[model samples]
Target: MEQTLRETIRNNPKKILGVNPNDAKVSLSYLTVAFVSLLIGGILGMLQGLERAGLIQLPSWLNYYQVLTAHGLLLLVVFTATFTIGYQYANLSHSFGGLLSKVRKLAWIGFALMLIGVVMVTVMIVLNEASVLYTFYPPLAAHPIFYIGLVFVVLGIWACCFGVFINYRYWRKNHPGQTTPILAFFAMGVFILWFFASIGVTIEVFTLIPWSMGLVETTNVMVGRTLFWWFGHTLVNIWYLVATSAWYVIVPKIIGGRHFSEKLIRLVIILLVILNIPGGFHHQIVDPGISQSVKFLHVFMSLSIAVPSLMTAFAMFFVLERTGRKLGGKGLLGWLKKLPWGDVRFLAPMIAMISFIPGGAGGIVNTSNQLNQVIHNTMWVVGHFHITVGVSVVLTFFGICYWLIPYLSKRQLTPKMNKIGVIQTYVWTVGMALMAGSMHIVGLLGDPRRTSDTTYGGHEIAVSWIPYEMVFAIGATLLLIGVIIQVYAVFNMMFFAPKGHTEFPVAEPEDDATPAPLWTERWGLWIVLLIAVISMAYVVPIVDMILNAPPGSPPIRTW
Candidate 1:
């Protein structure tokens, strides 16, 4: 009987057993770091908001720019990256029955390298030795160590990327004539984008290292800025793609319904992967040296991303509507009422999906050439980012947490904790609404971003911005409260939840639906196309920036 049980467990590891304890530990450790970073970054965000509103004066030992730099790095790079790795690895492990031992080792190595890099970067930020902000844009150089730390971060990401590749190759070789599992497919798309996205930034950083060390007198600012945005803007979509994975596969299961057409889903993923990198050009729309024709062509490339986005939106809606109607929901709008609104697992992501309506519209505005010029450097762009990332992406991540953490920890989410999560979601939504909303209004009034002070010696126009700034302070306070509650909930779920079996929540397709075609798995062809598209959009402008470059500037430390 014991031998029979062992064989059963081996045959159905994910179901009969659960996530391997070793594998669970790897994911949990990464998540712990992610949430901790969120806590610190949240505090810094609150400080920046209050200081910007003139509600408090910062001490000499710390400055607003320093806080800004740390906040961006902690939340954007550390928090997001760690969370993504943790979640994706969990998906990979569960979908493939279990991760290989070697893949597990690579994950641990990746974690250690990331920790070392984060420490180096954080220490520099705390000591005020590096305040160049998250973009690390050239001409405003940071400490050489800061740049070196970033190199480590990239290396860590690459290690994980290679681990995914090896595991994927092994899976395909072992199971020929079968399509990859859907969740695993999404994971591949994610790491593929991650690996390619880092390439430009990696090159830019290598150049900066020697320049920051004074081994070179100057470095090309345009090239550096372009490279950073190549990674930076694509980073936003990487988050979007991660969120969509949940929307596609996880949410349907939560609602007791099947997913949309597998073919359509794969097509969306393929389109996104092929067209994403070139979309970064819009970030550089206003910069010089790039010709108008190039910018015009890039505007189209930037807008092309919306096709996949719209495809995602449509697919999700179809699933929601179908599920609702099947559950006996009636009327044109009654299907909405059938959703599991009381479940935090559903509520958080529901709001996230809804928030994207306006968030996506805001994105279209930012991508338009003339429209971008109007709000390019204003608080409006900040507001747009907050709404899109804070609500759409982070909230989706929050939703995943309620289930994912419990699943990995071998615990069940209690009702009381669900209530707390629901409350946290609403609090975050309202806070972001107030904060991001006011920012948009004030930005249109000409309030600039990235400035420590916009008072302009109390000029009437500047004075007019004060009331909105105060709104920012209030919204920020609420957001901090939300952050604290969320951190508490994550830890509680991780270590203290009731011991029980929790489902991994993967959805299946309808019985009658067609299987996803094998052609969709042609990743090599997709990658070659990605390279071609990137070349078409970047080659002319980037070559112009490098070959006809201006006299490069020395490091200028503003703060």
Candidate 2:
């Protein structure tokens, strides 16, 4: 019976079809580092949350802002970016049969560079030499090593991207007229986005490296920020795209359904590529130096990208409904009850999807020029992201890890532990609900963000915010509990779980009525479009800032 099950899994069309077992271990090398960064970053984040609650005091040696910076860079940059690449390799293995020597070598190069950079930047943060926060915009420069380390990290990623493309190019040559495997398409979309998005940061960091090293005395703060946001806003969408790939490509099969439209999936990826770059300008709406026309353009463009998300929501419903009805479900929403809620794989992404609904609304609010002014930089902004990236993206990733860790490590995720994974998801969702919800309300109430002490003016309105803070503290504690369990489950799966095998499950997609278009494969055209849109939105602003910019501020490490 066990052999039959293994054979069935091996023969499944939608399953991760890949090469040697050794290739999987190579892919996991990157994932291992990512998990390590996530754990450390999560711990720092909990410390930050507790300090906010006044539950405990961090050592004077470890300042709040420094911890904040570490938390942001480690999780957002180190963990997410590395994880995306590793997962790309995993997905690639589904098509390539296994990684070639070049691919493996490049993967290791990327990993080494990233690990070294992370360690250097981390040490700098611990010594309080690089607390410019994650943005690190000048004239508040970081240590030279910090900026240089970032450059190494970016180069590492680019090498990995190069490796993926090489395999892709080779694959296309051999499989002419075949639609690229969906998993392969997913990887191309992700790395193409990364390739374009990294351009801005590459330039931004190069500029900072010189200044940090004292080669240039002054740097335009405006240009620096403009460059960073050009990179920053898209970074959020990159993570979104990564998580959504799993949702779109594998999710249907999870519920015993097929993709609704392969063509639609391709369109969604294309739209994200073209629309997401222009959307970055929305992040800079509040800056006095940026043009109103540009910000307005960004508002519409950013809002435009949200349409694909809406499409995803509907398609997901259709898949769920169809699958549930086939499984004997009935009524308007009864199919939802028929979902495999007990499986942590489904449960994690489900909670993430549910949480993103509110987060999406908050994004619209933030995009508005006038509306954003009302809550900009308040805890509302914090709450919004806590829901979006914090809850949605992070939860999805953790959920993926539940299956991924065991599959990659050849460890068994016991039935009992699967229940523990599900519990962790709910605990996180509930805690985020309380924490992020209160943040939105308090943000609207005008509580400032990124500050340690809340006391000010001593007015009644100011005093009223304390209860929410206490509630937030309670939520934070609950969230940390979930984090602990999630991390423990991961390490348990990696090192201590009984040896066993689990397949990388791929769900059946609903048969598409319309065939995927040939143009969807024309990645070059879309890449050109992406470049054009980004340049159109940013070129004038960046050039204008450089030609007639404000004086650069000198570096400061003030707490």
Best by TM-score: 1
Q: What is the lDDT, from 0 to 100, of the residue 385 in candidate 2?
A: 88
User: What is candidate 2's lDDT per residue for 1-559, written digit by digit as tens?
Assistant: 9887686565432343323566677667777777788778878877877777667778878988888899889988998997888787887876655666788888888888888888889999998999888888677778999988888888898988898898888877776886777778878888888878888888888988878787877777887787788788888998898888878766666667776678888888888888787777777888888778877878888899899999888877777788888888988888888889998888888888888889988998899877988898898988998899888898888888877778777777798889999999989998899989999999999988887657676778878787888777877778878878887888888788888777676664445465667678888898888889888888888888878776677665565
Clashing pairs in 2: 19-97, 253-507, 253-508, 254-507, 258-509, 258-510, 259-509, 259-510
RMSD of 2: 3.1
RMSD (Cα, Å) of model 1: 1.4
Q: Give the per-residue lDDT digits (tens) of candidate 1, residues 481-554.
A: 99999999999999999999999999999999999999988899999999999899888888999889989999
Candidate 1: how many backbone clashes?
0
Candidate 1 segments whose C-alpha is farther than 4 A from its true place: 1-8
